[model samples]
Target: MASNRIRKSALPGFRFSIGFTILYLSLIVLIPLAGLVVKTAGLTFPQFWETVTSQRVLASYRVSLLTALFAALVNVVFGLVVAWVLVRYRFPGKKIIDGLVDIPFALPTAVAGIALTSIYAPNGWIGRLLDPLGIKVSYTPLGITVALIFIGVPFVVRTVQPVLQELEAEMEESAALLGAYRWRTFRKVLLPELVPPLITGFALAFARGIGEYGSVVFISGNMPLKTEITPLLIITKLEQYEYSQATAIALVLLIISFALLLLINTLQRWTNRRLRSA
Candidate 1:
């Protein structure tokens, strides 16, 4: 029996490692989420329903969701262009431009909000030009979308950059040799390879936009039923000591965000499978 003994794993720390992982997750993630659920559970079903579906709350939900969606979609288009430019071409000050792409990641959200508000306010530099054109950027839903776009751009750029870099330049050259136009080459040769990462980037940007707070707070003007976003509404509730109602709103947001992300991930998986099969 001693001679027949065998080791179960090549590494020795499995038990300790797994135990630590579970404990870390419970403390950092699971436990807090559980507390949120417990707090929200204090509300009766009808109360929770009315709290999350009130006219003001519903307006916030619409503003948050639609702005996030629009920002993510815009990022997908322009972020792809930015990634393509960084990867495909060499130009002067290229490094500076590339470094600037990460400014959002390093800049504080509050600073971003303040700076954006200043630049886009009614009497501010660019805003003065637009204001005369009857275009308002700050203190409106449009301003919220702009704030989200600023914060969310980096997510898309960073996510897609590596994938674009890994792509072979010769693929496009080969397509051109086969008589494909630039647009055709990109559509036929590059897009399939790029779709998965684009979806991932969209998901990341969209998720960030949804929970965004500081970056949006100043620009939005926080007008109830107009420029208000859900996260701000949650904060307002918490400030008023409406703990259960705040939790209920947060729970609804959490559930919807989770469902949307799950669907995006599923689509990504399906795309991967299709790519592999083809």
Candidate 2:
């Protein structure tokens, strides 16, 4: 008696594919990060501590973190509303409106910075109107938040849009039939389903804003210890030929970002688990 055996495809074996994937990731991601860590190693403990914990550096971190958080929060609310409208309603210029959501995605960061600066500058059209009220938009912390919001809005919109489309109308109908009011239905049924994607989008936008330079630099006025952001501080360090100090600050930023992302992931997982159990 003889037996026949099936063999896997030979075009690309699993082992070969995985090996290539690891190699690609190492070359593109891990290696550069390792280099950064190594460069930062050149700094003494006191030097590294001084570089990252200085008042100016601390202020930049505070501004960057707060602005990013505020922007991400704003996006979460508006993004959900936009996604819901697009998913549930039909109107004139619907396609055009949908296309407009992606404009930020296509716009260059520097161009966005310049455009925002012009519109918000004291003598510019909109700014001129607000100037009488003493509402300064450009060259301030508020301006940085505006820039982050501009660049971050699309992330939330795009993330939540597909989820909205896939949500069954029957669910809403069932909730209404069960005497759930609109707000109650949304809070109890729709919002839970949206949470995971919303959190993911928030994390992405926050991360992007933390590292954002081009769009924020012009609008923020790059005033050290005031409106300056961490990226600009990093650039300033480089300009002054403080390579070790720059890398030290970069290392601190990398660590903090990694920790924040990990925390967000943990919270997302917990929310998902609670949703499933409910």
Candidate 3:
């Protein structure tokens, strides 16, 4: 009997496209990641563990993770509001506000760093206002979180905006007609549909925060075991020609980021499944 497999998919040149995709991914993504792992293999197991778990490295990890978490959470809340406003309301300068949302995407990271540093520096306008209040932003972990929040907001807003735009206001109206309160309608009707994409946005923001270096190094003051983030430490190691140690720390970061992203994505999938079945 002949095999029943289709030789071609509906997409033109499907096999060729798939082959090219795999080739591209292998060459660009997989190979480099594999190389990083291989380089880290130069260290003994004990050395690898110590390099990744040293006091300074651990502090950096904590700083990165905590700041990313805070930023992601903040974005989830404010981003939802921004997305809702843009999609559901008509107001003056709406188009301009929408355009502004993409500014962070276009801006260079270094420029963002410099702009943020200038705004939040001790002598800068906002910084000077906050100085007497003892609320320092520049060169602190708080400043790092603020920068991450700035860059991450766009991710959440963009992700949720499309979904919100597609959602029918009639459903919300019907809920209200049924005597559903505003809070209850949003909770029961809107929240379910939004959860998956919201989680996706949160994951994206968190991932970006983890990898952020340029925008953070300037604002963080790069203080060892204080303001230093993991990526900055990796750069420090690279600058000192400690390739093995750098790769080891990178590997640990890779593992942790992968695990967190995997967990959030799993939750997203679960919510999607539940919504579909509902």
Candidate 4:
């Protein structure tokens, strides 16, 4: 005979919750994206293509993508090191250093831009020291990468820190006892666990660097085809009241960013599945 009792769902009201979630996401995310697409649709294909492919606009894309990529890569390396240091050792001012990592998140981006510009300007303190070597940090592409790196560092450190914390030191010791070198222990043991979170951090930092505006604006010096970023180009178009052109450029950025993020997420998922199987 069939059991008399009915099986209850582990999550009661899951249907209602899922419906609300979809509705919320639609209102907040889908609607805005739809509006962006609709606004761009006002342009003919030729107009849209021309707006996004202009020499100045194309230059901005290159500068933005290249600097953002460099910054994110730098952050991934340095951030991981910082996270490891914080988790694996205690030093004087450790707490202070940890607190400092979040400064970019709390500080106003405009303020960050101004402060970075001041410090890196040719006449400024550090700038004066570096000027003799002919390395210019302010008013150049290097400055833009520096600004992006400053803002992106926290993403990597924060993402990796918790994961590093969860990993026990005994694992490394066990590996050492088994005749593994430090590099071998890290590669054979710790790295697999860290890969997912590192990718997450890289994605976050890369995305932020791509879309960054305020902190980069002042430091970039807004020179067309050199240090100018895509966000700044968007603002310039808006100020000129070229709404259709602005939307077209924005749509291109959106599409590219979405594609890159989708690829990264796919990689993350594959890595996770492999790790689980291992």
Shift of residue 270 alpha carbon in model 2, Å = 7.9
Clashes of each: 0, 0, 0, 0
lDDT of 1: 0.90
List the pairs of residues colliding in candidate 3.
none
TM-score of each: 0.90, 0.88, 0.90, 0.86
Q: Please write out the lDDT profile of model 3 over residues 100-189, one tens digit for every residue.
A: 998888998899998899999989989999999999999999999989998898999998897787777898999999999999999999
lDDT tens digits by residue: candidate 1, 1-278:
55444455655888899999999999999999999999888888999999999999999999999999999999999999999898889999889989999999999999999999998999998799999899999999999999999998887788778777777778889999999999999899899888888888898889889999999999999999999999999999999999998999999999988887897788667755755554
After superposition, the stretches of candidate 4 with alpha carbons farther than 4 Å from their true spots are 1-29, 263-278
Query: Which scores better on TM-score, 1 or 4?
Result: 1
Candidate 2 stretches with Cα past 4 Å from truth are 1-9, 13-24, 263-278
TM-score of 4: 0.86
Location of the lowest summed lDDT over 10 successive residues in candidate 4: 1-10
In the predicted model 1, the residue pairs found to clash are none
Candidate 4 lDDT by residue in tens digits, 1-278 = 23433354543897899999999999999999999999998888998888899999999999999999999999999999999999889899999999999999999999999999999999998899999999999999999999999999899999889778777788889999999999999999999889888888898889889999999999899999998899999999999999888889899989888987896788667755754554
On the 0 to 100 scale, the lDDT of residue 245 in model 3 is 92
Give model 3 RMSD, 1 decimal.
2.6
Quote the positional error of residue 136 for candidate 4 in Å.
Answer: 0.8
Q: Please give the TM-score that candidate 2 achieves against the real structure.
A: 0.88
